[model samples]
Target: MPNIEYIITAEFHIDKGPSLVFQYPHQLPGLQNLYFLPELMLPDQIHKRNEDYTLFLLYRNLNTGEFQYLYNKNNCEPDPYFLYTIVLNLTNDEYKRGSQVKSLSILTNLSFFKNFKPVMMICLDLYFKSNDHHIIKQLYKSINEKSFIISRDSLNGMEINDISLIKKLLITSILDLPINDKIYYDENFRNKILGIGKSQIINPDLFIRKDLSFNSILNFNEMNIPIRIPMINLPDTIGDYLNPTDLNFKPNLINILNSKLSSSILNNELTIYGLQTPPIIILINAILTGKKILVMSYENSSGYIIDHILLILKIITGGGILSGLLTRYNIFPIIDVSKIELLEECDSFIAGTINPFFKNNDKLWDLLYDLDLNEFIISSNIETPGDNIIKSSIISEDARFLSNLQLSIFNYNDDLTTIQLIFRRHINEIIRILLSSKNFNNNLLPNNKDLILLLEGIGYYWSSDTTKLLEISCYQLISKKFQNLLYNEKLIYNLILPNLSNELNLMIDLHYHLQSLNNVSITTKINEREIWFNILKFLISGKSLEIFLLITYLIPPNSSTSLQSSIAHNGNITIFDKNKGIELLLINLFNFDDQIKSNIIMILQELEDNFLCGWCINLFLKNNLIYEIAFNELINT
Candidate 1:
């Protein structure tokens, strides 16, 4: 059992905002104590009068003082007793004289207090001096039914106070109290307690009795649905490839497809041995149009064929275009010939390389022969099985249109089997279109970096070939476009120079090509500065010593002077003034490890006799290069 001693007190002042203040004299012995003052706004009638008020403090607790044994046995019901009453008479002479005679005191034994029993309640009555307004306010409110005691004694006799439980009980008792109807109906009182105005309160009974529907509240039939407008107007040439029957076709899909098709056409030429035969755009178009497609290849070639097939499937299923609606259609990729039974269920079959076992096996061959040739599209690399070879037909009409357009432009022939030849034939036209495209003008080309990288690939692919035509073609096209695009000097020095070529002569040739442009004005001084900067960048990137030595030999002695002049011109400072370039280089040198610092020291040593070397040496001497101290020690010896 647990015990609690409480001397609870409350005071009401007419002038105070809260009007009522409650206090507990004795700390609750072991249980948590909670006091609640709702602080609700009093009605106008209560505030208007200077009248006397009386509050009856009614407490109902059974007396168990003489019935201890009965309480222990839980056998007898205890008798209830009235605790006390408090009075406030503002009209009294003492109150008029500012003595404030409003006070209440209660002392009682509540040893028999139990849970789920009404322990206390308060009744308030306001009386006016005038007979016109007698009993201006009256309220009978119940206290919490649950006793304040949270828990009884445990084995260790430790009491854990649960303040939250007490607070919840007190709040529920306060809300359940029957306030006067006048106060409950008052807008101000309702707002103060419920946090909502009377007009905002919904009446379920009123709504249920009335006939109402969504259509009655809103004129749905008269509402206009807004139409979506495309961001860009697609050209009719590419628009012809769009599926006319696709109701779900959207502008964004058309834009993406157009961009891809345009980029592919600009970068690659149509060829029989192209990595993606029939083109990815054509495959997308085929799926969009619900056309049947068959793909066949040998087991060895199946992997590469399947890769392309999976890429298309991923595009469709990933909701890049049709929002995965194409998955509902019958589409399947048959990789294993053993699962030939599943092929009958598919509207289209992407038949990968036939297993080698079927080559000599008559039974398997017969089964494959039974597969409709019209529904089968064979890989270009594999030889047709029967005397009447089943040539893969273009399933989508739009795909055929695009293919014909490519063939007409490039003049496809046996000699033009390689992508390089096809690209070479269409290079000039591709360049013209790319340079004039909206993406090029806006600098929003999605694969601009990829296009630049392709130039490098082309150059390397034909590096050992006796015929340097393809490599030269790649260089010319890249050089022409990059001349216009390389607006940022850092971009040209960092990205363009290294990727142009590994050969010293080719790099020099490209630099000269940029310089020789009629519109371009790359001075001898600016060119020299860029060359040294590129060499430094290359060396820092961990290039071989051979390349570094070659670059060192190629760099003119006045390269540093040229750099100083360029920096001076840009900053509008004299070249003779303190060298910012050397300061910047010194700052960067601190970032390098001891090994790289030593390498830089050696490079500077090779150029020591040159005029630029004096500035570099001064920089090293002024700033501590850690390696500088080691170099000085070696020099002194």
Candidate 2:
């Protein structure tokens, strides 16, 4: 069966505005709403432009007892069925009575809609010239018949890692054939690379060798055309713009993250905010907590920002490695006021809209991101509760990773690949610590251990069996073996082993403590003020005070007094960067429970008021903690 659900064509009628002229294989459901059909088929401002192409998504609710496995076998609100769409517009003066705007769309169940672009381009060109119904029927038939297949039996024996790669890329299953180190390319493209005409039909199987690009051949209209699949595909990576030969264009996590950051959406973010109070971090954390985010752009309605934010969310979720983990979240690429009813039904979503009306309605969303102003407004009705240990660890790790990125940007050393490698090593350490326990498998059900272990081992080694490690799924985003080992070695020797003050150790130690359950004592000395400050920051960030208190208790009373006096003295032991100190103190003051709030306040009082002179004071004054402190002081007076 074909993954394609429909091949639809819509156009602007001068008398009637946009109308769905033809849809092969019958009409789609939910088209009865006359307003929505046209709005969907013709996106906002689509008719005004001479030529435009947009990639947007539509969704339908899952029927009862359907896609249960896809929804993680849980009795929860099911993830909506995705309708991936690509609308291509071209203006032609041939139409006499109607508007010149004509479009062709292929609505597919697969997220790998890029593969069908070649087919769509061909069919649209043919249809515009002849306006024949046969084009749609032929296009549909060819796509379904020639679609790539991953055999069910092959999928059953596959590891979770391989399954995730397939689900993420959603195009070609590179592991389908058993050949080693082979690159799949369309036969025609291979011939083109060799600078030869289709004169001789050499065995294309021999052409497959270790190469960077994976080109899938689309058989349409007796023409064999090659379509290059991108190394990474996210919700926002709608159109095709990847070049395999570009040095910065490799299919790796670092390159992908850097490419995304270089986008106009993130460029605007970086220019407006830089390192201080980055909206990207907040955007990431909001998605992590499953908050309803509304990214509103007044001037644009083409779902561009919607795609940008969705990509950010996907990147944070480990580039679709954890896409299944996001089964609870919904994505509305572009929505109008007509979909207000749909928005109300969702408990949490990351949606985009050009409608400014959504801004006034705080009840509609938890986070309102105004693209025009580059501002984020939190709904007053929302109460962001404190994070538990697990949530804290995840968010803190994210914070540290983002902080390191900012540090790199500040130092003019934006080596994103190295940074990504280090972060992966950090995660690998955590995985190893968890796997160290012999009873880890016993913690999960018999059937679930493989999945749990696979999830745990992502970005680390592919498999325990050395023989099968080389055959692990897709190569684009998977960390290579040599790079992985080199980075891990660099992390220990350069980052961790040399400097005890490195914040990375704090996290590694915490994971070790969690796995060992306090059995592993802290033998590493914590005498330096830098280490103490890092411990305090880590504890504050993680909301983990058990270790802090335990370490303090283990220290002698005189040393504790020495540490306190050291804070007040003008020695190297004292924190000189008062701005960072105040910022850290304020965050802890606000996020810590009421029981621990007083301790944070005392720490704040110990810091100098001169620290308030920096750019962070504006943030400090906006917080309620200062007001609370002032109110208490006034009452005492």
Candidate 3:
């Protein structure tokens, strides 16, 4: 048990009397509980502030073992009662220091830990940022100044002592280390860290190693080279123009951004490329508009566009034309003589890819925020996006790593269709901001992509990535941006709306739709699924459709065959089939109580809807999966 000691937590009356009784220290605190020791020790004064009662805890001195007046201060500030949810700085300071500091600390009231002394840990959130060394040094200084080291123990309690007395402070500082000392490029170390394993003892000498290098082009680093953002969005896109009020880049790259702006949900895959491209910035003269941009080109239909791209490329203006055939694979390899074979296989028209915005300062980033790049003047058009990609190509998961050894000028990071657009729209802006970053111009490739994606997966860390750790990060915008993409009248009316295409185009459209569907809003889900079925139905007649489904295994036999079969069968709206609607409903009812497996069966049986009731039985038989969700678990062998 952690701790359940009561100090003081007086607040608005509940049942006119007391709170639940606290039995242990780590147990959850509720109504009238006298928790002896809790993970979160609030200040006594605040806890007992006339009806401001909350869970309590006792902090014992590490050296003397004497108890101090540590009580539940959770009920102190603006939202005292909701202190657990507060995002505080990782520093030992649990109290409010400022609004910008987002912390990670959890304090559990002791009620659940019956007899065992509860265990509590000070939570630390880390976000990846290149200049972590300065922050870490500050943190080390804070530790030296305020909190002391302690031999944590469940047997007794946290024993305090001078951190110096403890020899090794044991304070984890992977994300906070100086860039040179940071081992992010070390593949082995990166793998371990990605797996969330404990890092080895960082050698003091190695922690200050000046021999390491940080390269941005992936030529000699353990990370992928970032295509200079300046080259992509154009430097002047965000800078002041001649008039400061005139430019013609329509709220430009809107729909190209993550599909969440509309809240209509499209593609659960936000931040797929690791670049935090927001939807609003993709619009009509987005660079000109101070705050909002909504641009998605309604130039052509998918089928017609494919044909047109082919036609346009046939009469190439003296260069290799772009095509899916060129950038078909997922493994984008680093370019170099050694990786030539990799490039040959990709057949990409990658050529002349450069980060036109190449500098080593924060000036460009700040400039963009303060100025307008699109309004500025430029002498010539950027080398047609990634002409360098034309000269280079490879699709490998380790392209980021492999490219470190090869001086590759272009990246197959984006697909043929998406790449040209990303480059055409945002290259300059990206370059402008990137130029301002020290990490951008360093020997090391700006491996910020790795950091960004990693943070996306693990939430925050001890310290987080700088661009990612903003007040409103790109993640928050993904949903809204995606929604806006779907509703973009031009995109729908032109590309996806016409409903003119053979099965292939339809399939391509369906795949894109599916890709966007992951984040689809509830409002659009049924229609989207219907759209998928309609597309599939057009595949063939009843018997032909069944035959095709069998050949493709789109409609697998049952879950007992394989777990993935169940997942694939998820949206079973396959037409030219029986009970398609019923199966769909059963899937809606189907849910994993354990979440990983074991769909709760009763939620289906109890359904009042006839469609749900009928399909429940069939789906159960198909999956052979039971609903273990929050239900009683028992067995008799």
TM-score of each: 0.16, 0.51, 0.16
Query: lDDT per residue, candidate 3, 1-637, as tens digits?
Result: 2222321211112223222222212333342232322222221222212111122122333444333332122321111111121122222233343112221113323212111111111111221123122332322222223211112233443322111110110111001123223334464433222222233232111111122211112111122222111101111112111111111221122112223332222221221222222332222112211111111112221111122222222211101111111111111101112323333332112111012231122111111111112211111211112111110221121132122111111322211222222222122222112222321223222223322110011111111234333312222333233223323311111111112233233222222232233334554333443434443433432222222221121111111122223335563312212222223323433333333112223223333222212223343344434422222231111
Count of steric clashes across candidates, in order: 4, 0, 158
Q: For model 1, name the residue pairs that clash.
A: 295-351, 297-353, 298-353, 299-353
> Per-residue error at 466 for model 1, in Å?
22
lDDT of 3: 0.22
Task: Name the weakest run of 10 consecutive residues (lDDT summed) in model 2.
Answer: 490-499
**lDDT per residue (tens digit) for residues 220-311 in model 2:** 77887765444334332233222222232222223223332212221111112322334554454454345678877777545455455544
Give the number of the best model, judged by lDDT. Answer: 2
Worst 10 residues of 3 by lDDT: 166-175
Q: What is the C-alpha lDDT of each candidate?
A: 0.27, 0.43, 0.22
In model 1, the worst 10-residue window by lDDT is 207-216
Error of 3 at 18 (Å): 95
Candidate 2 regions exceeding 4 Å error are: 29-35, 53-82, 88-99, 150-213, 221-223, 229-276, 301-303, 325-327, 384-399, 407-522, 525-637
**Per-residue alpha-carbon lDDT of candidate 1 for residues 1-637, written as tens digits (9 for 90 to 100):** 1122222224344454323233234332221211221121111122323322121111222442321110111332322111222333344564443323232222233312211011121222222232211111111111111122322243433222222221211111121112223223543542322222333432221111100100011111233222111111111101111111122223222222332221112121121222233343334323433333444334223223333343344333221112222222322333344345544454333233334443333322211211212121222322222233112332222243344334323332211112211121122222222232221333332333323311111111111233234333322333333334333211111112333233232232222222122112343223323433343333322122223322221111112343345444664222112222233333324433554444445545544533223433454454455646655654455
